[model samples]
Target: MPVPRPFPPRPFHGWRVVQAAFVLAIFAWGIGFYGVGLYIQTLSASRAWPVAWLSAAVTFHFLVSAGLVALLPDWHRRFGIAAVTRAGALASALGLLGWGWAPHPWLLAPAAALTGVGWALCSGAAINAMLMPWFDRRRPAALAMAYNGASIGGIAMTPFWAWLIAGWGFGAATAVVAALLLAVVWPLAGLVLGRSPAEFGQHADGEAAARPPPAVAPAAARDRAALLRDARFIGLSAAFAIGLFAQMGLVTHLVSLLAPVLGVQGAGFAVSLVTVFALLGRTVTGWLLPQGEKRRLAAAATFVTQVAGSLALLLGGDQAWLLLLGCALFGIGVGNLLSLPPLIVQAEFPPAEVGRVVALMQAINQALYALAPLGFGLMRDVGSTAAAIGLALALQVLAGILVLRRPAP
Candidate 1:
């Protein structure tokens, strides 16, 4: 009663890392991912280049990023996170400048490739790796929170790029954003990414002492070669690849599909709605996700929900409400699709192997989904929006089944 209250515990430094990672996701997806669309449109109009050629360059960009993403763990281990992140920031800045300044059509190739290298280092796998050493039991929530930056990136960057390009022209706008990226990322790398839990003399999730690692499958593989042979790894990779392929395809085509029903502005709003729900979905899942195991089940359930959304869109036809409803349902699972994989890896694989496993899976997933726009476009041209959406639904269903499957003990 009369005694003085004890001091409150110190704030977790890992939360600062989470904040840094969040900012990294914003820039990573904002420029590296969503910025591709801006490059495609601006370059095509300004250079009078063929849309197909520019699109091919974008595809190449993603492919290069996918290839390099597989090597990120090795790079991180060799170079350290701060060094690698700062290097990526420099590369990305230069690449953006290249995107705006490159005069000839063929010049886009090298520019795209350079951007891809930067993208791989800053992308989801890197985000997962950054957080892994600092978080354990609470990682689901941590990842969910961190990955929300991606959705935010899409929401913020699209309009920002458009406005800047309109006023300053593409080259000037690109230069300004690139400089901004460097200013923000350099300090972040030094301040947050460079350090670790042990360095801070703290435990993950702010525990007083370090906890024992969770139980992993006896069949879990320790090395990349062994992981390639593991059934669990295969299943996880396949599930995510299939789901993402469908998702990217649908999202790429969504605006055109809805334009007739909702007009361009309305369709844009729908896409923004999807991003909002994606952020909301991930936040809820992070809070509710069980401590260990069941992550696969949660992932499967996400795909199933997406499958329903696909069905609703397939049937929505001229009904705007129904289409909007489909978008909300589909969007609810979008963030989970990206955030759950690393969590699943953490649950099923050894801690030491988490970075490698996540990297490889991300690479595979990115490589496959890079084709979604073209694949879904072909489906739309060959048939109709319904046809494309139907294919997405089928893929989501397959993903659900695959995620639920486990290899024999």
Candidate 2:
């Protein structure tokens, strides 16, 4: 019999760090962060509550995260990656465990809320911050691929989760999800992850293992006051907030909103398919960003496509194929959302505060995301799809113009 090779020594440089980090971000966020959307319908169906009511749990998650992001840097400093990540994993497990057997909306809401809270801690505090200390040059692509894990995980698991929910029920599915969190993520967080590249005998910028991290320029390191006063970052944040509002709004009511088109048989199937397209968007954007400064091009293309797709629903209606196409377009636009703000922060803010900057941005992003679904639900409550789409398109155009005027951050 062939002998197994010994385990590779811990990588000090090159792509291994990036690879490990990316894989970890995927399971850490996708299954943890975006996977909540998959259960909205199941909750609504079982409870007979309005989609708005049940999906509000997602908004609550966002709210909690927004409130907590300011503390992320402090948390990282105090606990390190392994501790923070493991805590997140454990929170996820407990949350999922809570969700699995939740007998009513009261029980499920808290469970889902816990999962979202855990995600905020793990995703923002642990993953995003840790990446900065690893490599500077390939950071954009690495961050892109890592966050893309959300779409990838959602795509891969949503369908199966749907099947499980359909065949077995929420309790068993929650158990499986709990197992995935506890067995895989909890261990990964504690065993292999580190707080900063320095722990691995390397600089944050990924030069020779022995080189210390480059000292930050006084200018880059001292931009905090400027960041708050800066119109550019504020505008950029607003622009992102507008788009996120629409996207989160859609996710909040996706199953109910499109149920007419997808029908009962295809609801779960359609969501998974849309998420697959989102995965494609993430992969493509991560690849294209390396060769050129095409952030503007990406933003423009996505805006135009989203405009057309949202209008298509008004004009032609959401046939299965058309709806899928719209989902793809939405995903295409959203891929930029995953990376652009982080990239912008790296550019505009001091490198040392990258973690702080993201915390701020994420707070803004999540707060707006939390408010959107209810706002849209209220809009849809009183009007037709055409009216809602019209408003969204108009808002999107405003955001597009605002963002494109300056180029993506």
Candidate 3:
């Protein structure tokens, strides 16, 4: 009998990177994104800050972060992902602590801005840049697994912070959360985000044997100005800008919207449910969909769901079931909002240009979404929750239409 050849080992390292990215996503979104609503509430109660002012600070946070994110490609090339993430972790920790302990309300803007810096480094843009090189054939699955951390963050941390703030006060609760963030994120950034697969003599998806790298087309030498002139980029940016504006606006106000009707604990539960459905939606899409034209369709469908959810919220009144249902439906597309934009860019753009394109897209998306909270808060201040939510629903409907437009072949 002929001797059997030895089987090669599976590539496990890439998965390690995925795992670390998952943890990083949890911290980044949990503390920076979902936690914003809680901060607004706490500051409103403790410091008597108006909702609009607090919401504006949140907008400022995103504006600054968008500028930082626009520079991510150059930053990664110069300093590497690990260094970038490390700086982000430290900044996030310090910012959180500052936010918790600020004696005067005036300090909140700067603190929020600092936290924004951390967010830019740890957000989806950073996650995509880190994981893209490690995954190809499995890119969808890897991204789904990592981005789901955002949902998990909402599920786990929202209630945890709500409870912690209730029990220990905002200052103590925030400090503890910040400490935990540093403890978890610093080590992971150091250990797994240090290098890409190629740097360690591996290929994407951890292929067991070495093979010649695939030939890549030389990226267009056009600068950001030329890229801005591209029709496809403009279409993608406008679609997502409107979509995220509605989504983020609703999310920022979700807890407050439900609190009067559902009570604080009930509102927290609704937010968690939204996140649970978001996780489910992203996970299901990853398993069911292929990686190309279908992405836009999926994203468009999700936007429609958000529109329906917003309408439900507008009409639900004080009915707990309707509110919960609205949150669940709205959440069906939440995770996809973050995941699809990058995937679409990957599909439409050249591999060499993916980083810059993704960065620019993120910047525009952030800039527009940054206004969501301020606008929503202003509406809430001047009108009823239903009216504010109705405006958001309209925005989502418009976004859905924008995204549904078929691209030229």
Candidate 4:
């Protein structure tokens, strides 16, 4: 007699979590992060606000969000992911509405602060916490798929917002986007994200029923304190801080940089192109590169491309082809920059400590990168656009060097 065919593999809940995280990331990054530059341009044109002043609002948003991200580990433990995310969704809606209706520049500050809080709850840190419990062997792939939502967000929203503001006015356009956020994100949080695998009697990666859950050492206060002083953590923080500072500054000014040459719509498309290549970069790294040193080296290389991209834009002048080429090279590294940090922490640190370490690093990175737009904007106001961009490029080069240096033993 022929043997019975082997049973099909059971479905993994981790993949489900990844799907939920993907959707959440789309809204979080699309509206919360990537959309800010669009807002800055619209508000500046319509209200005649100074670019530096409007950019400061974006900086404030990041500062508040960074502070909240630093507290996420404790918040996740106390409130659960579902509650935190749901609350974030509500806050984001309100923040968007407030931003749309704000009558003066000062009013934008509180609105941005609210958005910051919502972003801290719903973005990368939230994705990490949700997926960590349900993945191990497949974590990198899961993260890559989930985080690609961020690039997709940039692809979808940049042009849409530009068109929306052009047609419907900024206030109405902002209101519509806010409604979309609530409708899309709230239900997903309730359905797929609240509970961990253990809560439902499942193992990570859907391993055999007989397999025991991995034991994670609880992170002690002293351990966290020690991490603060650790050379590796310090190195990672410095590299990413400088890297993101440059990246954010360039991206925030990208539309303004390209608009004179490409017009508003063309500039939006250029931003989308950057995200498209970013998606490809993250996908290739996740699929082909093994975790650890190879991944770290790949990340370092991406920053080098970012430096090259910056130089191209600066030198390309008003040539559309050259500017687009520069964006393509820069985009190749964007997603990897966002996705690699948590992966590196997960690979190097203890499982229990991963959350805290990631939180701390994110907090520090956000705090530094928050200054990018404001600094770049001020430079643009006082110096030439080329001077502003040149400064950003120099920072990217510094970051590349810092990241390439091997950590101390």
Q: Output the number of the lDDT-best candidate.
A: 1
- Against the reference, the lDDT scores of all candidates come to 0.89, 0.67, 0.85, 0.84
Q: Is candidate 1 or candidate 4 better by lDDT?
A: 1
Give the TM-score of each candidate.
Answer: 0.95, 0.84, 0.91, 0.90
Over 1-409, each residue of candidate 4 has an lDDT whose tens digit, in order, gives: 9999997755777788898899899889977898887778788888898877787788898999998897888888998888899989888888887778899889999999889998999988888888888887778888889999998888787778878888998899888988888888788887889867766668877777735655864555435578889888888778888999989888878988999999988997898789899999888877765777565687778888888898889998889999999999999888888888888777777677788888888989999989887788789999989998899888887887777676764
TM-score of 2: 0.84
> In model 1, how many backbone clashes occur?
0
Deviation (Å) of 390 in candidate 4: 3.1
lDDT of 3 at 183: 88
Candidate order (lDDT)? 1, 3, 4, 2
Which of 1 and 2 is ahead in lDDT? 1
The number of the candidate with the highest TM-score is 1
Query: Is candidate 3 or 4 superior in TM-score?
Result: 3
lDDT of 3 at 105: 75
Tens-digit per-residue lDDT, 322-393, candidate 1: 999999989988889999999888888767788999999999999999999999989888998788999999
